[model samples]
Target: ALIAAFEARIRAQPVHVAAEVQLAATAAALPPLSAPVDEEAEAPAEEAIAPRAPQEQVRVRADLLDNLVNHAGEVAIYRARLEQQLGAFRAAMAELDRTNARLRDQLRRLDLETEAQIVARYQREQDSADPTFDPLELDRFSTLQQLSRALNESAADLTGLQGVLDDLARQYDVLLQQQSRVSSDLQDGLMSARMVPFDSVVPRLRRVVRQAGHDTGKQVQLRLDGTHGELDRNVLDRMVAPIEHMLRNSVAHGLETPAERVAAGKSEEGTITIALRHEGSEIVLQVSDDGRGLDRDAIRRRAEQRGLLKPGAVLTDTELDSLIFEAGFSTSEQVSQLAGRGVGMDVVRNEVRQLGGTVEIHSVVGRGVTFTLRLPQTLAVTQAVFVQIGETTYAVPVASVSGIGRISRERFESGTGGYRYAGEEYALHDLGLLVGQGPAKAEGQAQVPLLLVRAGDLRAAVAIDQVVGNREIVVKPVGMQIASVPGIYGATITGDGRVVVILDVAPLVRRHLAQRPAAEAEAQQQRHVPLVMVVDDSLTMRKVTGRVLERHNFEVVTARDGIEALEKLEERVPDLMLLDIEMPRMDGYELATAMRADARFRGVPIVMITSRTGEKHRQRAFEIGVQRYLGKPYQELDLMRNVYDLLGIARARD
Candidate 1:
């Protein structure tokens, strides 16, 4: 039905139909990725999902944006440095005659990269059948090409004039790294510094509780605590809706009217408490009422009816409480504006989950239903564990990394776009494949490495090549421009000057979900597994050899020849493919050279994952925009490392 709806919308746009088909084509082409998503039994306790704790106090302020003042200051400092560079550039031009050779060398590099971009553009044109874009007629000069040459020339000319200035420049870079490190620290401090009191969200909510007294004809009193604690302002920004929603549920559904309280010889005024507190690394929030508690039987019945629970299934109390979060499972006896139309609580769960937090519920028959929420403390910067999948590397927050394992691929099978893992099914998205290339050195030829990361109650297994070690990184927003990229929560700076993105597993999951239909999502919600393919031609190379990748539960596909490969591809496109060099009739170089020339195979990473062992082959592949490079007889050990270099899997390392 979603597909039918999308097809209808797509048919409305003749121009977009091709892109739609291309997207669907891309989906169809995906091979099942390995499913390593299972709860690790021996995983460290820190990564295990925590039960809901008591509400914590947090101080918040309305002027959180004012703290961004320091980031603006960084722009000013950069501008001042650029001005100095401008003056130096002018003075150096006087000696053009002496260093012309150096300028030429720089220009040569620029020219080469520029030529590569041009050829890449040409490759795109030749690949497309649209006929309107003529590659030869539209020769656009690459801006990067021009900048590269200019920088080379400038650096060379500066070599002779002032050793002191050069020393200062290098020193400046060192100082800049120090300054960046300092700025990152300050950013963390500022995130904590600007936190508003948690009590702020409650006062505004208290009035609503008052209003419910008249509307529902029920006497109710509300109390809250823990407003003085400091919280990351960003977290507070999201706290309002859920808090209010929970309060409304308390008033409308949890509380008994005055008549019932009187009949029970209880006081007419009911009590609801919104309490908070801090426990170690988490801030907890809770909503409680002295009224009827949730009906576990009703929830289980509803869940069973919706296929969320197996009929007559035995479940623990905690598992039973988790059922209310499933979509369309509302315990409310009737529909109301606040909830029970079946959408409110799940949104709250997902929102909290995105922040690397969790939610749970508890109840007593005659007392009340208490909804507990746990949010991270500080929310500014976090220490993360970096790991590799195949050739690509990714950073998993040490806060959430449960454990690492290697699954046998022989036990898995592919169905549609994803694969099955363990007895439970999981959509296998190859880290290297999803991000655009095989990772730098991790061909995944050996046994695949799996890192488990938990978000809320869900445990996900991220496949990678190896672990690149760990770091304490300051979380920085990646800005709005590229915010949609999967697996990145925000940007962070390494101890070095490099900036790496903080991984946001929830959004990565949500983005993956947003790409699929409802039923596909349900299939995923089940403990199903998936398959992933590696299509490179190398038979013995580590990245493509044996069942190394198959170890992680991907249904590996190999083709000895291109014709046979294309047939396999049309029959099913793997989640990723790594091509090789020097084959019969269809050599790797020619295959890439020609495939990039066709529209059908444009975005696939046709890496020359072989021992081509020449600068020309590497350069040529780069010219046509091959995703990444690797030497022949590759080792699975380096798969995730390369993937990180190609994609940002392990960029947060020391």
Candidate 2:
């Protein structure tokens, strides 16, 4: 009916009446709905179901529940064994009871036999004078001898009972031994189950390094070695942030541009190698790059600027390298997506330590840098040396403890006086005094427990009331309220169920060293504020640098280019010249050569601060007697440190 109505409406439209009439004829010739539909219903249900077929399910990975179920079954098996052991123990106890009853009966028989012998002896003494009593006495004595023979038999029986008890005791020991083995194996298997491959973190690291290179306009070729090494899953997860941060640091601060690499007699591509491997029970990860290495002098100067060290404080190369891990410390002048916020390295150190790890750095002046992170495979357990400080108990990581000993009161010194150990002197830090407990019992003629610990490049002996030996402890995090407490890392429960704080040896040593009295002010005082020549074609560069130097109490001279700088030099030789690489006429290279040729300015220091951070530029600058090559967009601290260091000008303030 609906089709006929539609046909009639189409015909009334009049635009295509002939077509509409033909469609109506076709509709009228088709089979009507009232016709039997049995044939259509006879079609297969399978065909009507749209050819449904089963499809395999896709999953990202296997479910953890499967492994858990297997372990649960194994645990059940161990539980059954434990029940069997309990039954065996009960049987052994029953046998032991039976043996005890037999031994008690044997003892009673021996006591009765002994009493009969005593009675016979008394009768013999009373009948000694009578002949007729002789026969009776003989009978009584014979009875006594029989009783003695029975007592001997009872003694033999008692020995047999003792052997039975001993056998039961051995069986009990074997049961306990078997149970212990099963428990240990289960624990080891569980720990192993928690491990994962080190390369699990590589996919994310690759993305981070690639993005960093693109952002920095540098070509960094990253190669991973021993990626299949396994680590605890939790340790690997926590390590992601630190490793990613280090990778970003290498790309942004370590690697050079393709053009720069070529100029430095290196390949156009910069190479970063991340190698992982097992070192005994520990996992060793090395991140190394072939690039301009760390500048120790720059680091020392920066440390002084941050007030981490006094001006002109002398430190070894290793000590200087370690300053980078200080909180809120960074060398970059500008903040970017990658760095310059001064937060990465400290986080790296703290996180690594939380996993019972250490970070060591090695670098050469112009070759490259390598950061080595050594961590235990798992954080589930660790060996610690427990010590008692005042009334509090503390656990120090065994890895960080160098030695333990006792020092006589006469040999021990307070503060920076240092203590002698094995013919060597190291800084001595009294734990009590360091923690604000005042001087310890120094007047008493008693020996003090000294714990020698290594904190980075410095070794020091910490005085404590007592050394509590070593223990394997399960580390647990401290409450949030005390998370910021200095020198304490975490807490763990002792065997006696007492909670003890774990001491972070590194922070303790750092804290003590920082408290040392500064050496007397530098002997050499500057006669006057040093004069500096700021040479740059960019007016803004000249002004900024000049103003920075002036603020640091430096007399400033300005020049627009190398030609103008030479003119200024002719008038007077400045103590230092901060020259730019590119200029309108007679660029820095040519001007540097001119200055080297001059007799008066030959000894004067020339520092090149420029946007051209290529090795070729630096090599040329060095050849022309540039004392330092500082990259542009430099930190004000870096600039000041370099100026003060090169000019031999001591900081006026202590």
Which candidate gets the maximum lDDT versus the true structure?
A: 2
Q: Which ten residues in a row have the lowest lDDT in candidate 2?
A: 518-527
lDDT of the structure predicted as candidate 2: 0.75
- Clash count per candidate: 63, 0
What ranges in model 2 sit over 4 Å off?
A: 1-169, 385-395, 402-452, 461-473, 476-478, 481-502, 510-654
RMSD of 1: 31.0
TM-scores for all candidates: the values are 0.45, 0.52
What's the C-alpha lDDT at position 186 in model 2? 68
lDDT of each: 0.63, 0.75
- The residue pairs that clash in candidate 2, if any, are none
Q: Where is model 1 more than 4 Å wrong at Cα? A: 1-185, 219-221, 256-271, 279-282, 289-291, 301-320, 326-329, 337-339, 354-356, 363-367, 376-383, 397-450, 461-463, 469-502, 506-654
Tens-digit lDDT track of model 1 for 477-520:
56666775656666654433345556656455556545545435
| Clash tally for model 2 | 0
